[model samples]
Target: MAQRLVFPDAYAAADLITFAGRAARAGDGAVHLRASGGTLVTAAAPLLRQGLLDSTPTIIGMRLLPVDPELDCDLVVEAALLQIAHDDAEAVELPETAVPPPLWSAAEVPRSGWSHAGTLDLAVLAERAQWGMSAVAHALPIDPGDLIVQAVRGKIWSAPDEDLGGLPRGVAFVARTLGFIGEDAEDVGVRTCGRWTRLTLRRGHVLLRGPAHLGMTEVRETGHVAALVD
Candidate 1:
C-alpha cells in the first residue's frame, strides 16, 4: 500500500492551501523563497498525498510551477469557508472573477478529502460548498452545471404527491441520494449519519441531528461515495 499524505486535520490543510496560493503569486526568487517557508512545506504535504503536486519546491532541477491567481482566489475562498479561524496568514480578499475559463483544473487541485468533525457542521459546509463548487464549475469550459442538478434530488417535499407511506421525506431523500435505496424499495425508512449529523426517517419525516466526528457514515449504507474520473 502507499502512504496516506494525511493532514493533522482538514482545517490545517486549508491554511496550507491559502499559503501556497500566495506563494504562487510570488515571482521573483527573493520573494518566492521568502514566502516558501515552514508553513508552505507543512501545507504541501497533504496536497502531495493527493498527487496534486510534487512534495519538493523544485522537483529535480527545475522549480515547481507557480499557482495561478484565480485558482489561488478560489482556493482561499474554499478554505475560508471550512476553516475555524479567519487569521489565516494569506487572508487576502481577492475579487471573484466573472466570465468563464479558470486557469486550473480539478486534476491539479482536487475537490475532495474533506473530513468533518460534526454533523450540523458538515451539512452547513455542504451548503456553503455548493456555491464555491458552482463558481469553479462556471469557470470550466465544459459547463457541467446541468449535470450537477440531474445528480442530486434528496430534499423534503412536504407537499409531495407520491405515496411514500409516511416515510420521513428527508431520511428517505438522503438514503436515495446516497444510493442506499432503489426506485422500488418498500416500507423502508432510512437512518444514516455523517461526520457530525445523524439523519433518520420516522413517520414520513426526516430528523437530522448529530454532534460531530466518529466517521458517522460508518453507521449508514452508501453504494458509493465517490466516482472514478478518467
Candidate 2:
C-alpha cells in the first residue's frame, strides 16, 4: 500500500476530509482508503459488532473521489490524521501510516452484479435516523458501561426496517449521520448482490451484508469484512 495519496485539487482533497471527519464522529475514528485506476474509494463503519455473539450487522458508508493514478494503495488510518495532513496548505498528498483494520472491514462485499431492489425515500430515512438517535440517547444511563451502551445501540440500529423491505435501520442511521441524505436529496437507490444490500445516494453509498455472511467467530468475521475490496 502506498503511504501517500494525491488528489487532483484542493477541492477534491477537501471533499475526502469532510467525509473522513463525519465518519470519525459517527463511528470508530478509522477510515479505509483504496485506490484503483483513477478513483479512490473511502469507506468507514458507522455500526459494527464488537464481539463474537454481538448481533450488530456491519454497516459501511463509502464514497469515491478522483485521485492521481500513478499509485495504487489500500490501507486503514485514523481520520484525524488525514484531517491534520490536509491542514497543511502546501501539502498536495495526504500522508498516512496504516493502523490495524477494523473488524467490519474484513467482511466480503460484492463489487458487481448488483440488481436494483428498490428505492428508499429520503424523508423516511431521515425520520428513522432521527428516531434512532433519540432512542439511543434516552436509553443510555449517565454512566453506562461500554458493553451496555454498545448492546443498546446494536439492538436499536440493527432492528430491521419493515417498511423498507427489511433493510436494517442502521443503514438509515449511517446515511443520515454521514450526510448522505439531505433536504433536497432524492429517493436513495437500493441494490443487492448475493447477501450484500447497498443503499445508493448521489453523495455516496451505504452497504450491508446479510447476517449469514457475518461469520460465527471473530477471526472469520474480520477476515470476511476486510475483503470488501480487492
Candidate 3:
C-alpha cells in the first residue's frame, strides 16, 4: 500500500500541493518529502549538480507543513505526481510514490542548533534573485544545450556576495523562486549550524550546504546522518 500524508485540513493539503508545483516549475520536477511527528518538511532543489564533478552549490527551497502526528515518512516524489494524487483523493490526504532524485538531493541540512547568523532585507533578496535570473536569460543562447545552460547558471549563482553575508546570490534566488520572500519590506533571519545555512522567512525556508559539501561523502562518512560539521 502507498503511504499517505494526512493533513489537518483541506487548506493545508492544497497549500502543500501548490508549493510543490511552484517549486517544480522553478527547478527539477522532484520534491523531497520528509515527515516526522507533526511536521512535514517539503523541499525542492532550485540549484542542482549536472554531474559528479560539478562544483555547483547545493541549494534547496523548503517549506514546513503541518500533518497528522501519526504519519511519518521520508521519500522523494515528483511534484506533478503529488498533485495528481491529491486530485484523485476524496479527502485531505496526499499519497506518495517513490521517485529517485538526483544524488545531490540526498544531502540533509541540520535540523537543530542553528545560531542566528544575521538578517537580510527581503527587498535586497528579491533584487538579487531578479538580477541572477536576468543574467542567466541574457547569457544563454537561443535553444541552448542543457550543458551550456547549466554552466551559465552555475557560474552566475555560485559566485558569493559579500553584501549578503558572503553567501552566493543563488541563496536569494532560491528564496525568491520558492516564494519564500514576500513583497513586505521585512528582514529575514539567517541562521547557521555547522556546514548548513538556513534562510528563514515567514512563508518558508531555504537550506544551503557549503560548496565543499558533497552528497556521497555525507552518506558514506556519516552513515547517512548528513552531519557535515568540521
Task: Give the TM-score of each candidate.
Answer: 0.17, 0.84, 0.83
Judge candidate 1 against the unseen true structure and give its global Cα lDDT, from 0 to 1: 0.26
Candidate number achieving the greatest lDDT relative to the actual structure? 2
Encode model 3's per-residue lDDT on 153-210: one tens digit a residue. 8888988876566788898888887778777666676767778877677788778877
RMSD of 1: 19.4
Tens-digit lDDT string for candidate 2 (98-178): 789888767666776766566667788888989988999999999999888888899889888765567778998999878
Per TM-score, the best of the predicted structures is 2
Give one clash count per candidate, in the order shown.
Answer: 9, 9, 0
CA lDDT, candidate 3, residue 96: 45
Against the unseen true structure, what C-alpha lDDT does each candidate score? 0.26, 0.74, 0.72
What residue runs in model 2 are displaced by over 4 Å at the alpha carbon?
1-3, 84-96, 211-230
- Tens digits of per-residue lDDT for model 1, 1-230: 21111233555444444443432332110111111212221111110111233111110000122222223221212222222234432332232322222221122322233332222222332333344345444555555463342222112222121232232223333332222233332332222234212222211112223222242222333232222110
Model 2: which ten-residue window has the lowest total lDDT?
Answer: 215-224
Candidate 2's clash total is 9
Candidate numbers, best lDDT first, in rank order:
2, 3, 1
